[model samples]
Target: MVMQTINKIISANEKINDVLMNQSGLLDVVVYENASYDLNLLQAGQSLKVKVSLLGQNACCTLRTVYLSGTDADNKIEFEVIHAVEQTNSKQEIKGVAAGFGKADFYGVIRMPHGSQKCEGSQSHKALLLSDNACIKCTPELEIYADDVKCAHGSSIGTLDETYLFYLMSRGIDETTARQMLIKAFLLSDMPQAFETEIDKWMEANE
Candidate 1:
């Protein structure tokens, strides 16, 4: 496959395999020197699976995914990124919120094969629960076969921070607005500006 520069946004409503996979079930992304492929995905009340492969030296990918669950909704998402050559790099950031009896689960993996030396990969999954009945879980895995690689993975499931809320409330903001602001701050880094309206609606409806 010839190297092509690509930066695209993936829609949550479409099936992952239909949109991203080839006949062999892999999105064989061939990136090369000075090239990159970037994808941003948002999922609400749906399940999605994605596998991306970086095929050459100096290839790079950056993926940002968000999972939002509504009332009584169950959602799961899995992501895998494979670095097949030396000097490749990738970073994945995942964020989520579950409210009103909603449940969310995420699994992510970054793999670097034996000869893929000097490759760098990092991923983090973080989720928050808004209701007492809400549930959230995250599992992150890093498989590195090369000794000269830098790879890290982290996962966390938690609720909103009260101290940040308190700080906002002290400035005369109401409890509800303060809480929402704090939650928005947590997600601002990874979310795209294009989804602002949709995310605001989700927050309003979940509240």
Candidate 2:
């Protein structure tokens, strides 16, 4: 018999991503075996270090994070994913934005030591800078030592599309509102539908 992974939807527009929305406080780093996980790190609170381990035949997880730093703020994020068992898989997707005079550092790693066979892992990190002094550092690393496994990591940083801003403004949107709309879309576009409203509310309040 072939083993199967069950994914139960929490709501009409929610899936595994909503399972851990409430627990994604950027500090609740814990190992949850044999389950699909989604971690949404909204912003930097002090400095954060995240780590995850995948072991056993049924281990699977997906982690997602986001960060937006205000002016004159400094933030650092470090995370690692280790695959140590066979038939396990994991993925990490990260996004961030830094305002003027702010600095954000994103460092991530994926490791598959010897004997960890038939394991698959993937990671991606992307960030956007909002001003001249906005700074973001993305570093993705991988260490593979086992056979019959697949692992990859990537990082990218960019700025807002001025053409897109112009297009939005041409449609009669004020500059400030247009800017806010673009920022919101960049930060929350891929988030689960179940969380878009609540997170948008929180974002506005925090802004």
Candidate 3:
């Protein structure tokens, strides 16, 4: 049994070394960008890949909402992932929130190399839209060359749950306050503890 934690800080437009997290090994990756990057992970047995990408534009404040809320239609962020191996099990779940005119595009590809057996993998990408012009696209692809693997992929783009909003309203929160709370929750869902505090502060100043 192997147990370890992998943490790395990468500059923009850099290529990260291939990370292999074996059984019982934990991998955590956080990426913030104005540039591009390539990250690869391999799983011979059971593996976990935890990744977070913060794509922002310093030249424009309008893009901030798109980076966090996933609602700005003019903001464009693209993400891609590829998996290649056999008997390799993996789970990848990505969540994003967009506000204002921000936009996001997610692309995921899972491939089972030839001769791989009993491989199982699942991928899911979800985003929340906070404005009328907010835009998002999710595309998950699977290419299996082996016959004995079980794999699945899913993508969803939508706004906050109205039922949750209604419940908040019933509990005495005003509509705008409820919206703000929900939006915060959505944007912070996958952020790390260290960054969450700073992100909240930034949100306060920007919003």
Candidate 4:
């Protein structure tokens, strides 16, 4: 198993692959602070599984860490698998958060070739908006050239529910903390179950 988390301001392209089988390949990814990545490529095979999580914190104007306010921040992730060559397929889960006046974009593409049969591929992207001025763009794409493959993709961007906040506040939870906790939970929805420890550490830091 392999685990990796990106927690800095990234400005270049990157390529990553997770191959899970008897070897059990795994990955837990987190994009924190002012972290930024452009033209990122991710590949996973039928025998590989990976969980990706992204959190945007302190989109404020601080001297040490400049706010993430770039107009040309491009992030693209492509996950493909050839299932016929292998079986008992893999899984890919992606999640993200965008707050304040910051901008976020995610593009996901999952492909299953013609000969690949009985392969399962699922991809999802979700974002939270803290301010009305915040901007987020999501594109969930799937290319299936095989008839016997199961694949799906979904994307959503929304704000915290007022009713949920009210319920938490009634239980003695502060409003601000309630909102943060909800956002944190939403961003962590897609993370794999096996990486709970890493997820705990990330929540501690991001929250």
Task: Give the best candidate by TM-score.
Answer: 1
Tell me the tens digit of each residue's lDDT in model 1 across 5-34.
333333322222111211111233445554
Q: Considering only N, C-alpha and C atoms within 3 Å, which residue pairs clash in candidate 4?
A: 20-47, 20-48
Candidate 4: segments with Cα more than 4 A from true spot: 1-88, 189-207
Going through the candidates in the order shown, the clash numbers are 0, 0, 15, 2
lDDT winner among the candidates? 1
Ranking by TM-score: 1, 2, 3, 4
Weakest 10 consecutive residues of candidate 4 by summed lDDT: 58-67
For model 2, residues 42-151, the per-residue Cα lDDT tens digits are 55433666666664555666778776665655667777777767777888888777776778888888888998888899988888887788788888888888978988
Query: What is the per-residue lDDT of model 4 for residues 1-207, given as tens digits with 9 covering 90 to 100?
Result: 253332333222332322221212333343333332221222211122323332232111100000111123222233332232212233445554444445655455555556545556665565565567767676666767777767776767778889999998999999878876676566444443333344344334433
Point out where model 2 deviates above 4 Å. 1-33, 193-207
Candidate order by decreasing lDDT: 1, 2, 3, 4
State the lDDT of candidate 3 residue by residue for 102-172, as single tens digits.
55555556656676566566676667777787666766778777899788877778878999999999999
| Candidate 4: residue 76 Cα off by (Å) | 5.9
- Write down the TM-score of every candidate: 0.82, 0.78, 0.58, 0.54
* Pairs with steric clashes in candidate 1: none
- Per-residue lDDT, model 1, residue 41, is 68
